[model samples]
Target: MNVEKFKKDHNEILALVAELRTITQAGIAKNADAIAQQIRTMSSVIKLHLAAEDRVLYPALAKSQNPAVAKVGERFQQEMGGIAAAYMEFAGKWTIGSKVSSNPEGFKEEANNLFKALHERIQKENQELYPLADQI
Candidate 1:
């Protein structure tokens, strides 16, 4: 596996996280439009990154008979399913046809939580999932 390729995606994800951070810190009242834009941008980035993981990383480890590989691969994929859903829901609710939620404050709060979750998941994938995949 060209481990190097994965780091590029990591960097892209990190950049999106930083963008979200800036938007969230700006306060939903002041930056509602900008926040919505960033969410749209972030959603696109994550979709591509996740698709790459599904193509290259998950499948390889998931196919392994080695128990460790199977377990970690399965776990990451499962967690990713929920994360993807939450992301889609948030993005759709805030950036869809109508655009922006009814309550900016509530949307801001959800955005902050989403940022934190993405950050944590990326850390885990880098520290545990990808490393374990490399091992097996």
Candidate 2:
């Protein structure tokens, strides 16, 4: 019934994304260290958020008597696995400041794509998933 924690995590994730966007707008070469550090920070938050969802949220929804809700949960869980994997790869690849510094353009392109994916996922979770959970 209480979905505040997940909502808060979503807010934090979005805020970190906004900060990353702002840092990269000035260009990654000059902000490599900051970018890498921000990524690391976001990684920590994301790891915790995902862990919480896995431990508490998904299982509950999957067991729900409401078939529609269970289906949505299963779909979200399956979809998130890919997004999470991509994010882990992206975070691992760019966590080093030197890596970001060496290939700012590549980092920018990859980051743009990854961030877009994250944004879409978060929006769906907030608009669709959480509301379903609230109903349950």
Each candidate's lDDT (Cα)? 0.78, 0.96
lDDT of 1 by residue, 29-107 (tens): 5666777787788788888888988888888888887887888898899899999899888888887423443587677
Candidate 1's C-alpha runs over 4 A off are 96-102
TM accuracy, model 1: 0.86
Best by lDDT: 2
Candidates in order, TM-scores: namely 0.86, 0.98
Model number with the top TM-score:
2
Model 2 over residues 13-81: C-alpha lDDT tens digits?
A: 999999999999988999999999999999999999999999989998998989999999999999999
Off by over 4 Å in 2: none
